[model samples]
Target: MTDMIDLSVATRRMDRVLDGIGDEHLLAATPCTEATVGMLVDHVLGLTLAFTAAASKDFEGLTDTPPTLPTGELPGGWNDVATARLSALADAWRDPDAWAGTTRAGGIDLPGEIAGLVALDELVVHGWDLAVATRQPYACEPDEIAACLAFAGTVSDEQRTEGALFGPAVSVPGDAPALHRLLGLTGRDPSWAPPG
Candidate 1:
C-alpha cells in the first residue's frame, strides 16, 4: 500500500484511541515510563506536527523538536492536540504535491514517501504506546501491524543497536504473527499487563 494510505489509516486509528481515552486518566503515568497519558498523547501529536512540517518544508512555527518520549505535558488536552494534528495532516495531505515534496529539518533530508511511512510507523507504535501507557487494549488490524513490521524492517540493525531508535526488545511468542513478532522486536510486550 502507499504511504498516504498507511498514514490515513493510522491517523484514523489514532483518533479512535484518543477518543476512547477517559478525561480523568489523561494525565496518569504508566509503569513503563514516567510519561503521563497526556504527555504520551502530545508526543504523538508532536510527531505529526514535526512530520507535517518536514513534508511541507515549513519549520517556522514548530515550538520544539520531536523527542522520542514525552518531555512535558501536552499544551491543551489530548482532544485539542488531536484536533490540531488531524487538521494539520488533513491540510498537508490535500496538497499531495507539497506533501510529496522534499524538505529538511535539523539537517535531515527526506522525501515524501519516507516522511509518510515514518509517520505511519509512529502512528502505529505510538498508538500502542498510548494504549500501553493508559492500560487500554489496542486493537490494531493485522494489516496495520504488518505495515509497521515492514517499516520496522527498514530500520537497519545498526540503527536498532545504536539504542533508542525502537525501545528495548521484547520476546515474541513463537506462535505469534508477524506483527506481534515485530512489536516484540521493538520492545512492546504483545501481552503487556494493564496498569494496576
Candidate 2:
C-alpha cells in the first residue's frame, strides 16, 4: 500500500467556498481561462460524482460530463448539490481499500491511488477557483497543498502549457504560503484577481 493521504480538510475547505458562492458571481471570470465560475462549479460537481464512483471501483454509466449545471435561477441550489457530492466523495474514498487496486473513472481505468490524488487535486484547485472568482475566503492546510503539488508534477508539461488540464504555470516564491505554491503549480497566479 502507498502512503495514506487525507482529504477531509480539502473537502471542508471546498464546502466553505461552495457555501459562500452567490448567484451574481456565477458569471465572473476565474483563473481557469476556459471556464467561468458557473462552468467550473459544474465541472467540480461532475468530478465529485465521478471520483466517488471511482473510489469504489464502480464504472456503471461513467461517461463524458458535459458542462451542465442544473437549469434554474443563477446559482440556484448549486452549493447544496456540490457540497453533498463532495462530502460523499470524501466518504467514499475514506476506505483504505479504495486507495488500493485499479479503479474506473469516466469508463477509463486508473490506479485507485492516482484517482484519489486527482480527486484531492480537483477540490483544491477548483475550490480556489471558485473562491477567487467570487472573492470569497479560502485556506488549504499544508497536507492538502502538498498532495496537490505532487499531483501537479504528474501532469505532462504539454498538457499544462496547452491548457488542457491547466494553463502555463504561474510562478510564485518558494517562501509563499503552501496553498499559493499549489495554485501557482496548477497554472494559477497567487495574486490573481478578476478585473473590476
Candidate 3:
C-alpha cells in the first residue's frame, strides 16, 4: 500500500486562494484563459464533489460523459462553499478504506489509491490556477509538488498530444523550482499574471 500523503499541501493552498478572492474578481480571467475566477471555482467544486463520491466508492452520479463545466450558483458564498467541500474532500480520502479497492472518478474506473493521488494533483494544479489568476501568493510543500510531478510524468506523450488528459508539457528552465517545473509540465506558465 502506498503511504498516506498529507493532503494539506492541496487543501491549505486552495484555502489561501479562495480567501484571496473578492467578489469583484469573480469574472476576472484566470490562468485557464477560457475560464474566469468563478468558472474555475465552479470546476473545483464539481471535482471536489466527484472525488468525494469516489472516496466513498459511490457511483450514483458517476458518468461516462465528460464533466460539464459547473454553472451552479455560488449562493452559499464561494469561500464558504469551496472551503467546506474541500475540507470534506480531504476527510474523505483520509480513511484507509477510501484508498482500498476500485473506485470511479467521473466515468473512469481506477484504484482508490490512484484516485486519491489524482485528487491531490487536481487540487495542486487547479489551486495554482486560481492563485496565479488572482495574483496571490501560492505556497505548497515541495513534497507535494514532487508527488504531482511524478504522477504527471506517467502521462504519455500520445495522451498529451491527443489532449486526452492534458496539453503538451511546457518547457521550464532546469533551475526552476519544483512548483514552477510542475506548472510547466501541465502546460502552464509559472510566471503568468492577470492583466492590471
lDDT by residue (tens digit), candidate 3, 14-131? 8878899888888988777667888888888788888888988887875234567656356667688888888988888888988889888869888888888888988998888888
Candidate 3 yields a Cα-based lDDT of: 0.80
Runs off by more than 4 Å, candidate 2: 63-76, 161-163
Worst 10 residues of 1 by lDDT: 61-70
* TM-scores for every predicted model: 0.78, 0.87, 0.91
- RMSD of every candidate to native, in Å, equals 3.3, 2.7, 1.9
RMSD of 3: 1.9
Ranked candidates, highest TM-score first: 3, 2, 1
Across 1-196, the per-residue lDDT of candidate 2 in tens digits comes to 6576777778888888878877777777888776788778777777887888888777676533432443233345778887788789889889998899998775567788888887888888888888988988887777777777888877776778634456677889989988888888788888989889
> Which candidate, 1 or 2, would have the higher TM-score against the true structure?
2
Best by lDDT: 3
Where does candidate 2 clash, by residue pair?
Answer: none
Task: Return the top candidate by TM-score.
Answer: 3
